[model samples]
Target: MSLDDIRGIPTIELPYETIPVTEASAGIQRILSLAYMLVWMQSENLITAQLFGRSPARQLIFLMDETEAHLHPRWQRSILPAILTVLKELELIIDIQLFITTHSPLVLASVEPLFDQEKDKLFLFELNDNQVTLNEITWAKQGDVIGWLTSEVFGLKQARSQEAEQAIEAAQAWMRKDDMNQFPENLRTKEKIHQQLLKLLPGHDPFFPRWIVRMEADD
Candidate 1:
């Protein structure tokens, strides 16, 4: 009915369809939330009308920063698909150009079926050698979200925590060492390797079985 409690912006009274209801959401229940709602609600109406009308500059471009931000997993998965579906609903088949940046593996995995190598381009943003860089990723179906997290795009070796990855890397480094044939020249060297392995790796880790086999084989 009235407006108040705006932190930074000027608040205004706006009308909503205030029909009698048994329940109301926490968001729409408050004046502050209502003010925020009117802003975005009007923004979507105004921006679309201004940009996508029948004019010579008819090409539409959307630059979405962190497209998966504030979205639930299900919504993150459906976002790109929903956009394409909306395009199909339109009378004119306008070529919509979307440049979206996201860190969500779910967002990346969701588009596997719809990604066209010829039409859609994928780039992996990275910081290598203290410089920001973009690398073109060759399109490949990872089949699952976990695979996408571990793929070159995400640059995760095992989709694990920092400590776990370090342990795995240490184990791998041991395997790659040329001293596999001469793993231990003495009891001291053998004990050092044993302590290092146990310190870095958990006994129940899947890497253990193969590691034990390989160590015994070396001995």
Candidate 2:
């Protein structure tokens, strides 16, 4: 039978039910992975506490592949902060060893802020054509990383250039034209005209870009 049919079976009865079906499904795999991670981590912590009458110091090795695949860029920004909180919480009882592989620049940028200069805890490795290069980054505090990323490492600051303003304005003008109905009586014709207007005008921004310039002046 297919995996979905198998997933409906309870874990205690079936031999193959030990693996979570939620993890097998591609759509919800990330969520399932996170769930399994939490469950196993907590279970281990519980066992350690019971054995020692208090949680014993234990090292955790966590491996994650393409960790940001299911996350939005904005949401990806929170990953490091969440990891820090988890580490802090676990530090009271156990030691943690985190290992992750990611293709997302945002994910890399997120961790840049967490580097400790005095501790010398941050190391970055870049791989290309089967060759790996290592780089060390040191920061006095987490906030210093934002400047580092904006400065040389990722060049995120270049995205703030003045050319983005012109592009935004052109896109807004196009959207305004698209909203007008040339033949309001004929739905199909009006739609065609609207589509044509959209194609002719800037398609990037649906709203007028001029508003941005005005806002800048007011500020």
Q: Give residue 151's error in model 2 in angstroms.
A: 5.4
Return the lDDT, model 2, position 92: 68
Model 2: what TM-score?
A: 0.46
Which candidate comes out best when scored by TM-score? 1
Stretches of candidate 1 exceeding 4 Å from the true structure: 1-57, 91-93, 128-131, 176-206, 215-219
Candidate 2 ranges with C-alpha deviation above 4 Å: 1-28, 45-57, 108-114, 127-130, 139-219
Residues 75-191 of candidate 2 have per-residue lDDT tens digits of: 666665676677678666666666666655666667765655555354467676899977654442324434545643454643333344333333344345443333233222323
Residue-level error in angstroms, candidate 2, position 201: 14
Worst 10 residues of 1 by lDDT: 19-28
lDDT of 2 at 161: 39
Error of 2 at 59 (Å): 1.7
The alpha-carbon deviation from the true structure for residue 68 of candidate 1, after best TM-score superposition, in angstroms, is: 1.2
Please tell me which predicted candidate would have the highest lDDT against the true structure: 1
State, as a TM-score between 0 and 1, how close model 1 is to the true structure: 0.59
